[model samples]
Target: MKGSSKTHLRIVFTLGIIVLSIYESSSQFLNDEFCGNKEVLTLDYRKKPWKGKNQFLLDYLKKIDYKDNIDSVRFRIPVKFWIYRNDDGSGGVTDERVKVFMDSLNHFHKLNNTGFRFYIREIESVNKTKRLNLGYFVEAPLQTIFNHTKACVNIYVCDFIKKKANGATYVVRGTYNIVTKSVMLQRNTSSTGLTHEIGHYFGLLHPHRNYKSGKNKQESVSRTRAYKGSLKKGLICERNGDGLADTPAEPRLNFLVDNNCNFSGQALTDNWGDHYQSETNNIMSYPTHYKCRNNFTLSQKSVMLYKASENKYAKYWNTKDSANKIYHFDIHEPDNTVKMASIIKSNEKQNHTFHKIFTTGKKGLATDKTDWLKFELNTENTSNILIKFTPDKIVNDEITITIYDEDNKLIKTINTSKQIASSQIQLKTLKSGWYFIEINKKQSVSKKLYNYSVELIIE
Candidate 1:
């Protein structure tokens, strides 16, 4: 009986090992022959902070005559590519494919006089089986690990992106978000896919923005600027669909578009009973084929320019003018403690103001998640100190900003609750002394990068 029991235990352990091996092998490799469409998993604009920012961006762009200085306001964007291969460094995207994709990406953006150009800054090769077949959930850490360690658009090209749903696996061609400022794509993804994802990176929403949700009002087919007597009152084309008047209101152009790059399907009507006339060639649309998706409307170009000029995206642009020099370089780490705080010297010549734009975040396995800054106030009169924190990227938790004295005693604590929003603390009649400011992340598991700007004003 003892010998029989020993044999049973051995058999069970061997089976367990085999099962574990199978699971690990299956998890690391994905089907590379599946057909998929390019989809962007972006932060929902119907939500709080994103909704507010979306409206604010549109309002700000409306006030700007960006076209007047179109010739001189050209932007140069730097791009870094990460090509992933198997564990032994075999079977990844080819250099020729990357070069062709870049050419196509540039050609599409150049066609409409978009005033934006992208150039490759670096190309890195990643050899890891897990990275070769990526998933949506694993992308954040992959971004943190392969991050350029500087400011530029990071694009990861993988072998396959496995997405499981309803006991079956599907492929997601690409994804991008404003918070990460990164794009992940399958190596076989079309050049159109790359361009479309970049459009989302630049803040261009789909033409059928609210079509999938069915919760909000869809853009009506009417392009009428005068909404006093419109079918859906105040639902002008400019106010509804994509916030751009040039692109007509239409449903998702997925199956409705034909092979010849034309929308000649069944007549779909909007809520106002008007026939749809969507632009199949719009880069932001979901056309059936890559060839059918290759254009950005004139207003769309303006939107891209305005969005790229935001503080969060400042690191991606290369320019020399001081007015456009608001964003600074990445802040070095190890300033996590009070004694190791980075110095913030006020520009006495500029009204005692210390303002800078920087990028910082918590690493995956790093213990330090706080950034420290020390500044001195030498004003004699009854002065006020204003500290403002404007974040370009999204922070999942409230970033706690604590004010401490020279003795390492806490003075005040301000927790910013909004995601991708700005917060400010005003201290009236602040004493003249050395003070320290601590920017700490409340989240414990986040490894995503955060870009923000701090402005210190004393008067």
Candidate 2:
């Protein structure tokens, strides 16, 4: 009997291994093929205090006229709010609460000049229905509603249940690529913690830990200490608790109020907005008071703008198939500076005019030109191209235009030796495919090039 039992056990173990192997293989295949290669950019530091010294955050805010910009764009796009409620009768978000949340978001838009509008849709009794359970099954219905809507931003809320024993939250938030049809979010939870999580959806990382602004409080004490935190050991801070650098690090004991707490010493405090000495009134912190949780700093604003202008959100403004198709191209500089330009192509085939949509720096300077450039066209037939170059003003300097096929082959080159400042040329006929257009100056002198636009017409 013992020998028979041992043989049976061995057979069961072999079958279990086979099942596990199949499951893993299937999971990998889905992740690679179904989910496109979308990456979430991470912020630099996560455990320092926000003494209001993060530079990356600051620079981002400075680039835009927030008040005017957001207001201008608000009416142009619709924002959708998804409210998930607990069906178990514990407590669901009230309509008043929803109104308050919507108000806060709208206020934020007005303050930042986001120029976006919001529309709320509440999904009640989610907890009662197993079909709506987050992660796998729930995504299907939610995606259906998302596909039909014309909103630029989709906001989802859930009463996240965190398992106390495992310390894992049940809620997840993410942005889905409608093109690739994928979902992405920073983390998941059930609390009314919509603000921070929604910020992540917009591509904003935690403020305190970005490359420009993360540092220790002691570093500001002296210039020497400034460089000290830049090194290895000094990098550690107490707020390391929440993993956000803007929130100063505090040991476990500091979470509770202690009358004996020393506010003046090197010891960190538990109070809100205490800088290196304690936690700040920042909403990014764990403080329970709502008053302390207001406002995204200038740096935070800039990061959001940059992400909105560059990443997944960028598609909102310049969607794949809009009446006017705008394509964004990045120019990488040797000094690590990036320049952006926008191109617009028409849907109809005509005389094909190329226009200068947008450019950074001086309009006429050659040195300010970008090394890398890309263009977006309306039609898929990328062949038979015509380019027109018109400078801002008449000049004797020569301009060179190069055309390349999809394979990077130099198909045609037009060099003008005459003093003509504006001209147009037709390149060798192209097949029904995509191509690249590169523009540069012929002279070596550092001169500013002005308003030059390209117009493409396909026959």
Question: In order, what lDDT does every prediction score?
Answer: 0.61, 0.39
Residue 249, candidate 1: Cα error in Å is 1.7
Clash pairs detected, candidate 1: none
Model 2 per-residue lDDT tens digits across residues 217-313: 2222111222233444432332222232344443222233234333233454223324345433333332333344455544455544555565533
Return the TM-score for each candidate structure: 0.55, 0.38
- The list of candidate 2 runs beyond 4 A from truth reads 1-62, 66-78, 81-97, 109-117, 120-128, 131-152, 167-192, 206-266, 269-275, 313-459
Count: clashes, candidate 1: 0
Query: What digit string (tens of lDDT, one per residue) describes model 1 on residues 1-459?
Result: 999998887667445533433343342323332222222233444432223123444465466544533433356665778888888888898765776667677777666667676655556778878777875544533453435445667888888777664466778687663444567788888778888878877777778765433323456677663356534344355555575667777676667878888887447777666788777888887777768777887667766776677646564363454643443333233244565565676532111111222234553112235667778877543767778777655655557889987777878988766454778877766567889988876555443324566777776
Q: How far in Å is the alpha carbon of 70 misplaced in model 1? A: 7.1
Best by TM-score: 1
Which regions of candidate 1 fall more than 4 Å away from where they truly are? 1-73, 139-148, 212-215, 225-233, 239-241, 312-459
